[model samples]
Target: MTRSTGVVVIGGGQSGLAAGYHLRRSGIEHVILDAQTAPGGAWQHTWESLRLFSPAAYSSLPGRFMPAQDGQVYPDAAHAVSYLADYEKRYELPVQRGVRVSAVRRDGGHLRVETDSGDWRARAVISATGTWTRPFLPAVPGRRDFRGRQLHTVQYVSPAEFVGRRVIVVGGGNSGAQIAADLAHAGTDLTWVTQRPPRYLPDDIDGRALFDAATARRKALDAGSTDTGGVAHLGDIVAVPPVRAARDAGLLHAKPMFTRLTPTGAEWADGTTVEVDAVMWCTGFRPALAHLAALRLRGARGHIATVGTRAVDEPRLHLLGYGDWTGPASATLIGVGRPARDAAREIAGLLGS
Candidate 1:
């Protein structure tokens, strides 16, 4: 079956929801296509111990503020899930769950979104399928030869199974630091590994500050100014409560990334080695854009070149919430709103709605 809509939103997660909210506000008829059977997007898949970098109030979508979590300075994964699920219901966004988009192709003057359930003919398509599905694990020589258990951030639920195991956590990003802290708190024999020394944001700095800085940078760039002081001058990881506590306790120290993996452990270039029972890869993810492959929009940098949120090659398509390329910090709950609103406005303008 084929359905028609003014706009088609792929992925009903935070980015998709943000776009939906703005599109709805703009009086655009749209359908949100979500591969998941439920709401909450990537938040639902994160580990149980995961916490937001800021308070619930700061980490929210466009129209509504997330309610504070009881006695928690930073909300947990469950709280985020609850908020996202409720947001979908409260907004009455036209979300079709369990509908996985396979490919999108040009259909005359419209875009044809192919899915397992059906196809959609949309005047404009917003690809908001964020990076969660494409968890990245770097290829190190002898990685395949490792006999111990290996897991990615996406597959991890909690530290229950790994409580007593000797684990090596790799990656220098927030996920790596956060997961390492979770394992350390669980009393696991943990070895945190990074390509370089981990850089942490100030204790007072959080998502809000980062977003503000990004906004300033965007404004500066818009004004044709070169001095855009942004997050680049700051640290990589946010010092959330848990991460801060872990760092204070001297538990989150990281080792240099190993040169290769052996049968039972990792080996460093300096001939140092650690025998670990498991390897936890918190590397990160690339944008989940395989569905748009048929459109052939990806460029040499492995991303579709864009002017703001709209694809340069295909103005009929907009990419949301992938990262800074779409908008300044558009991956975050609060950050995605601006780009989403702008995208909706552009679509409405194009459609003469």
Candidate 2:
């Protein structure tokens, strides 16, 4: 059976929630399809120690502010999940959970959303399925032959399992720093490997500051003014309390990237080898857009070209929460609002509503 709506939102994560909020405020009827059985989206899958760089009050969606926790300066994964679940109910957004989208194909004047549950026809579609499900691991030789356990950020729950074992955590981003810290705190014999020296933001700076910078850059771009540098110049790795303490204690010293993996461990180009019991890849993730493959919209970079959130090839389709390409810092909880609002407005206009 084919049902109809003004819009269909894919993936009910933070981005999807923001899009839903704006679409509701615009008085546009839409339904959000989420693969997760419950609320919280990717937060549900994050490691127990994962903490947002900002406080609850600083990270929020379009209509509601995430309420601050009783004692946490920076909310943990659970708090984020709770906030999203409540936000969905508070707005009474029409979100259909446990519905996995299979494909999105053009169907005359509307787009057809094919899912395991059924099909829906909509004048527009918003893809907000974020990157959690698509954890990325670089192709290092001998990875498959490694005798030790390998894990990615998406699969990692805690450092408990790696305690008392030799482990190498790869990647230079926030995840790598945090996980390396977590392991060190747990007394794991750990080596942090990175492609280059890790860059840490000023101790006082946080996600809010980054978002503000991104906002300034976006505004400057809209005005056709000089590039404001945005968050690019600010540095990587936010020094949250844990990461800061870990680094201060010399527990987070990083090793240069290894040339390849050995059956027992990693080997550098200089022939130095370190044997380890496990390797943790905190590399990152690609956008979860496999369901859109049938549309044939991906460019050479494996991304759909976009002007703001609207896809250049198909204006009826807008992507949210992927990253800067969709909107500056749009992947962050607080930064997605502007792009979501713009996408909703553009979608409404396209629908002539």
lDDT top scorer: 2
* TM-score of each prediction: 0.97, 0.98
Q: What C-alpha lDDT does candidate 2 achieve relative to the native structure?
A: 0.93
Supply the global lDDT for candidate 1: 0.92
- In the range 1-353, model 2's lDDT, one tens digit per residue, is 89999999998999999999999999999999999999999999989898899988789888789999888889999999999999999999899999999999999999999999999999999999999989888889999999999999988899888878999999888999999999999999999999889999999999999999998898899899999999877888999999999999988889899999999999999999999999999999999999999999998888699999999999999999998889988999999999999999999899895
**Per-residue lDDT of model 1, residues 19-43, tens digit only:** 9999999999999999999889999
Clashes of each: 0, 0
Q: In model 1, which runs have C-alpha deviations exceeding 4 angstroms?
A: 227-229
Prediction 1 TM-score vs. true: 0.97
lDDT of each: 0.92, 0.93
CA lDDT of 76 in candidate 1?
92
